[model samples]
Target: MRHFLRPTVALLFAALALLTHRAHPAEHAVVITTTSTLGAAAQAVGGDSVSVETILPPGSCPGHFDLEPAQVRRLLACELFLRHDFQSFLDGRLLANGVARDRIAALPAAGGLCVPDTFVALGRAAAEALAVRLPGETEALRTRAEALAHEAQTRGNTLLARTARLRGKPVAGALHQAAFLRWLGLDVRCVLPGGDDPTPGAVSRALTEIRATGALAIVGNVPSGRRLPSTLASRGPPLVMFDNFPPSPRACRLLGHARPQRRPPARRAPRIAPCRTRSSPSPTSPSATPAGHCWTTSRLRSHAAVSPPCSAPTAPVRPHCCACSTANSHPPPAPAVSSAPIRPHSTGAAARRGVAESA
Candidate 1:
């Protein structure tokens, strides 16, 4: 039975797996992108017409990313590839693997994606490129691109207006964050030399510039690594990090409105019943023991074999007992045991004692 059960279960699982695979077949053409920004843009424009996948991890820096065999396979299988100009790895390594130039789309923008104008331009460019490959959804893609661009512009304007008072405030930051900070209307005092790890001389120079300019904040690029010289941060101002790549094109809509963290519900204290004794009839009875008095060990052991007292409301009164006190007047004695008979010892001195005696 056990042997048959194992094979039967395996067959059932295999059938379930087959049904699941057939239930949802691959429907959309795969689109591969070097960074999340490209993937997001493609998703915004392409909609359900295409499936977008990013080669680079969301938290990784483009310069630091190393391509794997799986990523190469993905690029080879994808119908379209999207990338930015700064991603040199594609040119040196990835594109060399028989991936044609016609399939690739580059988003070359002078300003950061966070800037309204640049964002709109990127969306429009992405729409145009994607519409060429996915012709059936051209009108829908164009409409979505226009809507996305409009949203970005409106939100960017509102954010800019809110921070208008900080238009000319001096700020030190990474080169990558300069465009976004400038778009937000801050005066970029000095650009940090390196991405994550800068040389000692560069850090000293940046620190000197920050101190001289009296920069109020240091903005860092999230993808490039949100780290700066300790001396610069300590002596200068607060370090603020801005992400270069959003998780999705629509992700910018969530900016400024931080999702409130959900806290766990408060726990309740357990209820404890009041202790009672055999003498107590009720909590309020005059003859009952005081409130904290409890049944002792001896009291519990003595009444273990005996029935509950008549004083207890649940216990029935005996026929002979007229009063409840008579039931508890005397406790029953413990059971006695008989000992074995003593035998006479065979030794000479032990015989006189009539029992075995130790020397």
Candidate 2:
């Protein structure tokens, strides 16, 4: 009887331990995300209630993300998966990998939750899903988020106002960014030549027009690579960099509530030195000047006479007279001049140039 009693007590203890383990299951929920940006948002919302796992690392191209087998399994085991509808890589893969629709949460539709508002709401929802109660102090967090949203709106307005000063001015950049700037009231002349990166030639041509028309700004995604913005900045006008992701605190702070940099007044190129010819009576004299110091054939012709009636010793003779003299003087060599008309390339021409012009 004593031996049976000892074995029974041991069995009872083992059963009690099993029951205790079952009663106190793990407290943390698992959250799976395709990118760190989304993972950060999930963590913000989940707070201490959930652990986040990002399948893609920072700075990785979101378009071509591929999940590992282990990551897929981990995702399947997670309590929830947060996804962005526009995320091509993650959304399709998750569905194909057999993740149930019910276990996923799509972000609020566009226009519903923007910037800081989206972040706060997502955080609250994640906490609620885990049955985690926020402390009374959470009211302060809510207040802060509201303040941030107001500040963002104010900043956006300020940016728009500055941009307004250059109303009707042409702008060009990434397609999505162009649309955003357009929404802010900018006249987007065109998108950068390629879908993402513009070729060197395309950039050169675009910059030429942008400079010619005096574009108000050249906007692009900051994370797209600094080369584009750096290139644009060096060329002319100011580059108004925009973040592709919804504004985060970091982004908001970077953009700030300050008004956009005032569009520096356009600087006109200095007039070229008037062309002079040796055939003229006073070869050192200035050539015929056209409107605003521009040299034209008509103005040059007006200045042609080599004799004294041309009056001013400093006045230049007509360009045609100089050309005629040159033709007679040097018959062997004709000055080569291109007959091509100066016209802005059509969109199709620019597109073709874009391919050949890639940096």
Please report the candidate that would top TM-score against the real structure: 1
Clashing pairs in 2: 45-123, 199-358, 286-316, 300-318, 303-317, 303-318, 304-318
Give Cα distance to truth, residue 136, candidate 2, Å. 18
lDDT by residue (tens digit), candidate 2, 326-351: 11121211111112211222223443
TM-score of 1: 0.61
Give residue 95's error in model 2 in angstroms: 4.7
Candidate 1 structure quality by residue, lDDT tens digits, 1-359: 99999999999999999987654333365777765556655666666666766664333455554566666666777778777767655665656887777778777777765555665566678778877777766787788777656555555455555456778888886787687667667789888777455567767788888888878777665555544534466656755445454322222211212111111223422111111122213211112111001011110100100112112222211211000011122321111101222121211232323211210
- Which stretches in model 1 have alpha-carbon errors above 4 Å? 1-27, 198-200, 229-231, 247-258, 261-359
**Poorest 10 consecutive residues of model 1 by lDDT?**
298-307
Which stretches in model 2 have alpha-carbon errors above 4 Å? 1-26, 88-92, 95-98, 108-114, 118-173, 176-194, 226-229, 238-359
lDDT of each: 0.49, 0.40
